[model samples]
Target chain A: MIEPGSFRDPTSRVFYDAGRVFRGLSHEAAEVDAEVRSSGLMNDLVSRGLFVDNWIVNDVTPPSGVSSVSVIESERVPLVTYPAEWPFSILKDAALATLDANLISLERGFILKDASAFNAVLRGVTPVIIDVTSIERFGERGIWTAYGQFCDHFLAPLMLEAYAGIPIHRTLRSRTDGFPIGDLGRLLRGRSGFRKGVLSHVRIRNFFENRAAGMETSERRDVGKATLARPAIVASIQKMRGLVGSLESCAPSTWADYESALPYEESSIDEKDRFVSEAAVKAGAKGLAVDVGANVGRFTGILAEHFDLVVGMDNDPGAADGLYDTVRRSDFTNVTPLVVDMTNPTEAFGWRGKERAALSDRLHPDFATWLAVVHHLCLGIGIPLDEVVEQIFDFCGESVVEFVAADDPMAQRISATRSTDLAPYGVEEFEEYVARRGVVLNKKPVSDTRTLYHLKGR
Target chain B: MTDPLFAYIDPGAGATLAQLALAGTAGLAAIGKLRMNKIKNRLTGKVSVDSESEPDVPSDESAATE
Candidate 1:
């Protein structure tokens, strides 16, 4: 019996048991896989180690196409990640790898049928292309079926990071399927924007996209090349790579707010870091977490030890930039940073339909750190304490959070510009709020105005 | 006799944890539980607990209190 799964790629179905894996395909899909294999694309990818464990020959004849297609039994990989979880550098690397894969696919007589970032998943620092089904033979009139997808998945996000000084963090968490066209288009179409390729690649698609909004339900599909001339596809892919780089090199971070604001004073920062490290170890959390107002990831960096993983999430590019820069400079295996607007967090969404992984879903029962974060969400962002508790309890098992006073200078700065709809942040109120939701550990005073509360879900 | 293991791979960060101890005599069943629950949750998006963070007793502190 086969337990079929994986919804992103409609054509291929993944199955596994006893350390073995199988891929079920309809007759046509198997034929396509065979074509990809016989055409030598599979061998090329295997040779380059671009793929994870590979297809093992099998005899489960599928029921589509000209003839029955047999299942391609394969080895099961240990992990499957979506783009939303990746830090900026990892996403960039995935895009570069995808471009490289496209180039390689052309060399091996195939084209990446879908250059969507979802085709890749990270295993540590290495970015491996996971979706074998997203390939087809190269042809002269090859349409970038994944073109619109790539724009949403890779190009748009990259450009946002490059030009607008927004880290692609929101794109990752909010758009696991791919960044929504409307949002990316809005970002790219900002006032005085649409410079060069942005107009061509993004605006053009946005036009067709708005046009295609609801005219047709969908259309019948096929397995073969949309077009099969090698030269044209290769040229287009090359142009795409150039465009991607320009998107990457658009502009670096230039936010004065980041320059002016201090995430943490030197002494407070170090002590906070040490405190987090000790807590994460004590909690036996497989991972440590920092809410994005994470500033520079100092707490996450310090807690990176002892815990198997550390996640630094912050909404600001200037802040995420610092986090990403640290991850890039170090060999810290466990640390990751994401862009999160905590006031409106990214919700869980699926690959195909609603029956897949959401942004917050995870296999690990976790331990987390929400340091220096609640105040920004509370005083600055206007999220309620109860909702904050709910978000944490949903994602983590045990968590530690900092309750910064409304009068704190840092709190004042974060809220000075924004409308603080919520009442002023208070330690007593926060303690009571936490207690109602779960068992609140004793408070550890990080400062007169800033204190950390350890928590366990009741 | 056979053994199994528990692996939690966070999709966003790609930070995964594998508990080798979960494969031993003490953990063999725990491994089975992990695998079982993982499959259930993977195919079906079920957050193990809802109202998980809801306070045991209602709190006066809220958005108004911040």
Candidate 2:
């Protein structure tokens, strides 16, 4: 069964059961029902290849007391994917889909009552509008009726990623409803500088946003009954999309600085890849595989050899994007990349309640890998080795994790910070901590310092 | 190959759009009625999705287990 996403707008969210999809629209949105029908928008869109997202008057009635106002129903989608799992191009398409949906709604004599990235979802690689009932009539609209919302969701995140090379939306884990304009403005402050469009859309606008911090929740503010005079609204969204397309990361990273600092010899890197791949095939894992600290998914590709699907999780935005690009370009549909610090994994989507959803609440992988990642977690991130063991056991049944002994070049470099506390961290301590939780059967020394533990649950 | 388009793009929106247009026009027929009590009509029949009424929603315990 498909679970409902956190799309809790006042309007109805579509639900699909068995084989049919349904949306539940209330009287508020149904006010323009007649006008919408007369405008032939539904018909026009149907003819122009719009999906049958919302159903017409169907067999299932809107519960007993929904008579005074109409509660129209619509079709539901099969599955819902969160924005965090989406690739760069997928987000771009969602942005375009939202703008397109808004334009289409105007042509049919209706205006989008609300706009949020959550309103769109990915079907295959395309973004589709999930809530058709969100459209409502409010008389003639202005040139940019949806300008503010577009700014909040699509435009803001896209601009930040393009110009600053930072996936700003990842910050949503802290502040929901996309990024708060205030925080985004603050994040932009320390940034080096910006291009022209960034100046108009974010930098300058932020000065004005700072003027009114807690005046009112942006969602609840009264936008008035101004309709987006169809053309104006469509033109507005289109212009925003065009504006988005114009922004681009100027060039790749300065390869000289990072690339030249080659810590590992080519043979050593190859040996690590071969070691992870060999262990996974030996383990006979068949379902999902997860790679912790999957920088650019190098080991994810290796571990992927033993599973149907692989998830490469990393905290760095650049790492996730790089991994996603590699997977996409290679047509490796089996791999899914996400931005998540192992120390601060997504506890939950926070839909029903803010319970700490065990990491497996979303994915249940059979096997896992931790190649060259343990050092970052133990020494760099400061998560206790014991808790790290528990988190790993929570997600995988059997796994191969490489422990970068404190003396390993990487670990030593990570802990080079004089302030770090690595007194309680060591391969012996990790082995003992994980052994109490699971069977640490073998400790095969991969090198003079690091050791690979073959772990299995009780 | 993954579709170059975003995954959420619906294949059946055309049919739904047609039905919405038809229903929209039907509702417009009562525009005069809508105006006289539009405010009241708009707020009417809002389904307050209270926890008790949300039967399909699963509890945390239920979600964790199979």
- lDDT (C-alpha, whole model) for all candidates: 0.57, 0.56
* C-alpha RMSD by candidate, in order: 18.9, 13.1
TM-score between candidate 1 and the true structure: 0.67
Best by TM-score: 1
lDDT of 2 by residue, A45-148 (tens): 44543333444565665433233244444444333445655545556666776666667766655556556676675432245666565555534533233445
DockQ of 2: 0.02
Fnat for each predicted structure, in order: 0.00, 0.00
Residue by residue across A174-238, what tens digits does model 1's lDDT show? 45556665676677655626565665556655553443222111100111111324554465557
A267: Cα error in model 1, Å: 3.1
Stretches of candidate 1 exceeding 4 Å from the true structure: A1-10, A15-22, A31-50, A55-91, A125-127, A139-145, A160-228, A249-265, A285-292, A349-356, A362-365, A416-425, A437-443, B1-66
User: CAPRI verdict on model 2?
Assistant: incorrect
Candidate 2 has an lDDT of: 0.56
Off by over 4 Å in 2: A1-7, A14-93, A100-113, A120-145, A161-170, A182-194, A198-223, A249-268, A278-285, A303-306, A348-360, A419-423, A440-444, B1-66
